[model samples]
Target: MSNAATLAGGFPDLSKLPVARQAHWMRWFTAAAIVAVLLAIGRAFANGQIEWSYVSRFLTAPVILQGIVNTMVMAVLAMALGIFLGIVVAIMRLSPNPVLKSVALGYTWLFRGTPLILQLLLWFNIALVFPTIGIPGLWSARAVDIMTPFLSALLGLGINQGAYTSEVMRAGMLSVDAGQYEAAKAIGMGRLRALRRIILPQAMRVVIPPLGNEFIGMVKATSLASVIQYPELLHSAENIYYANSRVIELLIVAGLWYLLVVSILTPLQMLLERRFARGFSQTAR
Candidate 1:
């Protein structure tokens, strides 16, 4: 064989191409696969086996509006409480006191270790364990009734979410350099002041993206409260479907609404992330 032919056989061809050209081919192949799958799904939908009217009607229902409101309410409330508790736990975990650190670690481990569903159920039935919770001389009611399923759901979701959030916060804290902490201390900042003013602001930039994801997850997680009859989005959908016998249609409506909420939030999240990322850019410069 000629030297040119021998070299071609030895090198296999793509040695002449730039890395970017190779990447382009890889992306093209991925896009083609994605397009093929989408087309297949579209074909299935086009077969006319699904009832579109039910989905439309379900979407238009006032109950769905209420459910959406309820879902958002629960998600926001849970996230707020979770973030607050997370801050406390994260601080405690990072504290020098061994007792505080151990307690924080135990709390995180216990909650994160258990299933969220079980926690919700336990909260729902917590009143069962303590028939009444009140001042010794104060009036009291059945624990179960006092802590309604909704209240239980909120507490359960919020506390469990806090456990996870604490870890996220802790990770963010650890991402900050020790030099920053030392610098804050050198500037005559107290421990709490350093944490609040210097550390947290920086840590939050790292935390917000994951926090946004956690919020999105919480939206879905709120649906689990439906199991205990909390009447959030999924439960509301289930209620309507049961009455109308349009299970699949109602579910599709619920799914669409969830998608819509997530879509709206995604841009907001990206915007916040970008805003936070500005500091990193400035610091790099």
Candidate 2:
């Protein structure tokens, strides 16, 4: 019937009220599009070449487990080194001295300008340029002996992370109120003492969230180390598939392991955010 038709109560039908039918129809169309994508994914998974049985068989293989352990270790070490470098660079960035700021800026610009894969390759093959690396007049070690896959990967990933973490650290430090710094100085704190004892503790509230994300990202980014023959999770999966030719299945296993690792880190990240954010409740009397 026409929307203008009067009801028994002498009121036009409810459809007479203005409504956006196009958006309503679009919602259903969007749902249908989602269903189509899902169906496509299902079809791909159902392909005979996927080999679900092989995926299940190798999911927890010993070598794969070892790779996972290696991945975790690399992520932790890289993130720790990155955090240290970030703090140092951030302090330099904040310093009033022009020389310190320039040095920090140069380091940041050079590292960020280089692609990560190139950095990894460079570190792995650095022995070609520098036969030995050590403090001059103290001792020296062969570059080839020191720059193993693990060490090279750590240096590349960690140094790259430092460039990013430096910005995060500087932002967090800037977030703290200027009054807090003045107050620390008023209380007989030296500049370094004030930063260490008063400012950084409070800045942690701002810093911890993104720092947690950097850690989790480092975990995922560790996959890149596979190119260096670092034997991380993805590399281990490749070794298996290379022998058996079960490429997709082994890849699936590696993906599942990565998902599991990320899933664990996600909750831990949330917990740390919450912990650092204590005392921020607006309702506090």
Candidate 3:
């Protein structure tokens, strides 16, 4: 059974034979089952008691439009406030000063520990605790007047988001190599100056993905503010359903809008990730 003798005898070459593809019966079956389930659900929705007409009508309603606009406005402002506070808090968390570090730790613990809805409710009802606020001699206003639903929602969402974003920022800063800090110091940069110029820029790449996700979450979290009468998308939908009693249709309209917003944000997030990840390896990106 020598190879040379077998070749001379004109036997077929085993290496050149076509390889047989294995059948993935289980995979095919699973995929088919999933499709069947999805179709069944789709059929149920189509034939359900839901009024498609109401969904279509309210989809472009003035109140619904306003609600979506408010939702976006709050999302942007809250995220901006969160980012600013997060940066400051993260820096303090890493500070040598015990006071600063403890304050930062306490802030994170307090906000992150509380349920978001509780925080919203507390902010909405803050007037009960403090009847008035402002500089005592110069300006004073009723707490209820100052802490309107919009302001309450903003403070609740932004401050809560800051606690979470601080951790994200701290993690990004920690991910930078120790040598980078040493290098900055070697070049005679102050800690804050080095952080502003060298560290933060580099850390942006690490933090952007999570930040985008957090922003998307913020958009959805605005719905929670509805309980406090903040007039976000869900609130608008609720109003419609209350007046017309078309609960499912109004909810479907609201759900569609949320989906649309998230769908748009997802691609934008990917773009931002790509932008920040420009110099990174393909796998890392």
Report the lDDT tens digits of candidate 3 across residue range 1-285.
Answer: 755566846665676678999999999999999999999999999999988988889999999999999999999999999999999999999999999999999999999999999999999999999999999899999999999999999999999999999999999999989899999999999999999998898899999999999999999999999999999999999998999999999999999999999999999999998998888768756
Model 2 residue 133 CA deviation (Å) reads 1.8
**TM-score, structure 2 vs. true:** 0.90
Q: In candidate 1, what are the lDDT values of residues 1-285, reduced to their tens digit? A: 654575745666565668763347878999999999999998987775678988887796899989999999999999999999999999999999999999999999999999999999998888768888777887767786678867888998999999999999999999999999999989899989999998999998899999999999999999999988998899999999789788878888999999999999999998888888885776522
- What's the lDDT of the predicted structure labeled candidate 2? 0.91
Order candidates by lDDT, high to low. Answer: 3, 2, 1
Which has the higher lDDT value, candidate number 1 or candidate number 2? Answer: 2
The lowest-lDDT stretch of 10 consecutive residues in candidate 1 is: 1-10
State the displacement of the C-alpha of residue 36, model 1, in Å, after optimal TM-score superposition.
4.8
Residues forming the 10-long window of minimal summed lDDT in candidate 3: 2-11
TM-score of each: 0.85, 0.90, 0.90
Residue pair clashes in candidate 1? none
Find the candidate with the highest lDDT and give its number: 3
User: What's the C-alpha lDDT at position 109 in model 2?
Assistant: 98
List runs of model 3 lying over 4 Å from the truth: 1-23, 282-285
